[model samples]
Target: MSRVLALLVALAAPWTPLLRAAAARPEHAPCAALALSPAPAPTGRPALQDAPICKKCQSTGRLPCAAHPRSDCLLEDEVLFCSVVADCTACAGAAWVPCTDCDNAPARARIEEKKASVATRRVALEYIDQTMKRPIRKAESKHFVLVWEMDRLKVDKKWLESHELLHLYLKRLEALYDDYCARMQITDKEFAEKFRVFVWQFPQDHHDAGLRFCRQSAKGGVKLMGQTPSYSVCGNKQNFQDDERLHRNIVHSVTHLILSAQRPVAWIGNIKAGWLDEGLAHFFEDRYWDVCDTYCYQEANTNVDFKGGRFRLAVRRMVEEGKFPPTAEVFQQNVDTLTLPMHATAFSYVEFLLNRDAERFNQLVKKLKAKVATRDALREIYGWSVFDFEAQWKSWVLSTYPTK
Candidate 1:
């Protein structure tokens, strides 16, 4: 077999007899899938996209033994942190193995590298008063800073504060963040820490000022509903005078920002597949119904009022017309190449996977983020062969999707 084929075979069936023998041997007591070798600190900024994946650990930045030079372990709180599955008799202390699904390399090297460079290239903040004739003011909570043009809003500070609606909106955003962390099964401390959000709200008179602040054009692609730049974590909003539009846009854009700033596809030097990427973003867009705190429920087409239902309906039409791509093809789609139908299909596919088993879906997210091959990761994580996944996913879609 060719080297690539051999690797695929290994990935397809990781527990082969040879690997079993190696694991059983006393010298290689804990069978490690990948080998690790540490080198000196990289000179200058090493290519973020060029970090090599160890065949043993699959670029997870983990290893079978703390003795391995690349075994990313630390002596924290008198515990011997290691990624090995088996106990390390050498260190009688506790071991801190990464969740088999988690990928630490991006956190360890990629984010730290980019953060250092990003911190140096700061853009000056533009105050609204100097640019626009309207009365605009800024208010901030722990994670978000909002600058709004007073004339454009139906609800003012007095009304918002009195109704506690302003607090509720900010709290809603916070709840979204909490929901995200809970789904990923990690804490805020465990993720990349740069999460401060700045929102620029431009009512009618202040919309021009918002554009000027962001240095954006006033027409064409300048609808500028909301944006989260790849270079920074903040989002800019324009013309979202309605409460629902504002809420939906904030949830959507902020989801992208959090994913970018946290597990960070940039750190991996690759973009995620469109289906999971956009689907997760859309999924968060409807995580809460009308309120953030009280009685939240699962988001689905038959049940939820979120826009994802529209996407699911679009996907259903494609399915009936025989235009929807196969599961394998969808899995391979890049965001740049995805069509509108593809987006709909991708979102539904993610929802399908999530509904089947959310924990497994989350594992698939981690594995994919680590740049594991899609088919290999699916087999390893979900234990579903390609044939099984396609058949089941299609069946689930036709049955559960709304026809109306």
Candidate 2:
């Protein structure tokens, strides 16, 4: 290689490992690879030690002299052209000394994990692009990559060819992701590396495919639905019947995916309260989407209409009938036992907490993500007992939610 290219490569080469290490442990600073200081000798240069040393110069605050590595600059290279200068890059060049154990077992494990993550991400992206018959750039800082099967969609092939619907879906998701992150107070780096999604065109296809892929069955008949089966994977059944329903299903399923990604515990134990999980997703599903404007920003409950007002009305009826399950009971229900009315109530409860104090809701989610128990997290973050919370939430629902 040319001298200039070699020098540039030497300077840049040290950063690759550091960047990877930093991504794995964002909480700490990247450790610099050092040059091993040699052992002392009476009348000759010291032998190089095994340990690495820092490269900074103490006095000049620049790169240390290579002739006397890590030194302030006492050694001069007399054989080079700029022989007089103690530390001249052109005359007295520096080279990176490979640190021992740099690619140890632990580092190799991390590399493998990163490679697996990238491969999964790439597959999801490719499937979506190819199936949609349109190219899309990979989304940056996104947890879930969407997969759609076009064969199951009910739309005419001519319509698909004419419109840029795929682009719109991706754009909406990107915007929604940003909004979700902002509301949840999630930093970009806190995002999980693995999140996969499949959106099938037909309801039956989505249901069967989800069960087959996840290697499990949903109890009480396989109803058409969208869900996050594992912490990292989510799937949805697209509705050719109603565009609104399709949007809602996508939003609901993706919400679960995002929440699942947030937890730091093992996948099996990472399940949040059923109410919060479903509520958060339902909350986003009902969020207003307008095609007229691109830059419009809507905060929670701002001119928001539950267009598919069934859930809202169902929740109101439950309150009037005095048959609503206690918040404690609802919290105990996993994805399996979550009834229809329970889903509505969950949505209302989430909306109540969010509209009342978004920051407190965020704190509640933060606590849950930290692996705190559902009951304890709610009590600590909201400062209310279960009974007290239920009472407050019921009153808020009865007053604010419309009966009609």
Candidate 3:
């Protein structure tokens, strides 16, 4: 026979003889066959005395040891000898040893498991790159890397993209503010010095999980939402995706950032009152909403009923009545709760005050900023009580836009 055929035949030989030997000399008979070494070992390492003759080796062997890296001892009678060197450079210095019955299956299984895990990780990373608008950089709080899950961000691709873009927009807005201040001859050294922005995207749990969207740290570090307002984006299912809604959400959230950035020294003292802080946010964001309305006119569709028509009437009435509320009261009675005849009332009221009389309104805001006390500040700015301001606003509404 040819050399290759002869070798094949030798390897294909039955293990019956080896099995008989095992039965006859159970104590010393090999349990597994030896495979041939691919290359000769260096001088130092011990070489196999001869090809192993275990039943498994004889039945399945080609040359050195097919099971050299691993073998099994069957009962106490059968000794499966593995003949491969543990640290042969020819074998890439890999250790070869008999597989223990206990760990053989698990070891092989672990290899497969690791392979799958690597594949999953690759997929998740690709999804993140394709879905996320910007690269998510690692954030540190003390020593921990804020490691979070992918599912927490319940917002979809568009929503997440828009949300993160808002963060980028804030940086742009800061630049814009710096430019505006410089051109207007305002010394913004103090204004620019007050706030530092920190963008966090936490893993979310569910669709509507509560993630901390935006918060001002005690030390004045601002955390802006990259997903929901209060929840982390690690474990949530993403769903938010209406373009208009997304824009509104971004504008609203960034407006908070801007106001927080420009927070006056006096307002900083009473920052705990939810009404005052949130109301101011509302006031600023409401104005921003108008600006967005004009800028993105095609996208401007009223999602909430702000009683705009009724508010216009109320403002007209208040103007005719020559009465307006102190800035403090407007800050006190949350703008959202204050009633109006039309849907856009609050928005219209803010628009009229800020757009028509920005100077006077800014003056009132400054005065309120100094006073801090809602009632006292209101009295000082508008010279009207809270109730009187409402009446005048309503009368103004009636006078400006008559229902009949």
Comparing candidate 2 with candidate 3, which one achieves the higher TM-score?
A: 2
Candidate 3 Cα deviation (angstroms), residue 114: 45
Stretches off by above 4 angstroms in model 3 are 1-190, 194-239, 266-349, 399-404
Candidate order by TM-score, decreasing, is 2, 1, 3
Candidate with the greatest TM-score versus the true structure: 2
Model 3 gets an lDDT of 0.35
Model 1, 195-312: lDDT tens per residue? 3333443233333533564444332112121233211111222334355655665676556556655543332113446567666666665455422210011211123233344666
lDDT agreement with native, every candidate: 0.48, 0.49, 0.35
RMSD of each: 19.8, 17.9, 24.7
As a TM-score, model 1 comes out at 0.49
Put the candidates in lDDT order, highest first: 2, 1, 3
Q: For candidate 1, what's the RMSD?
A: 19.8
TM-score of each: 0.49, 0.51, 0.36
Q: Candidates 1 and 3: which is better by TM-score?
A: 1
lDDT of 1: 0.48
Which stretches in model 2 have alpha-carbon errors above 4 Å? 1-144, 151-158, 201-239, 263-272, 289-309, 369-371
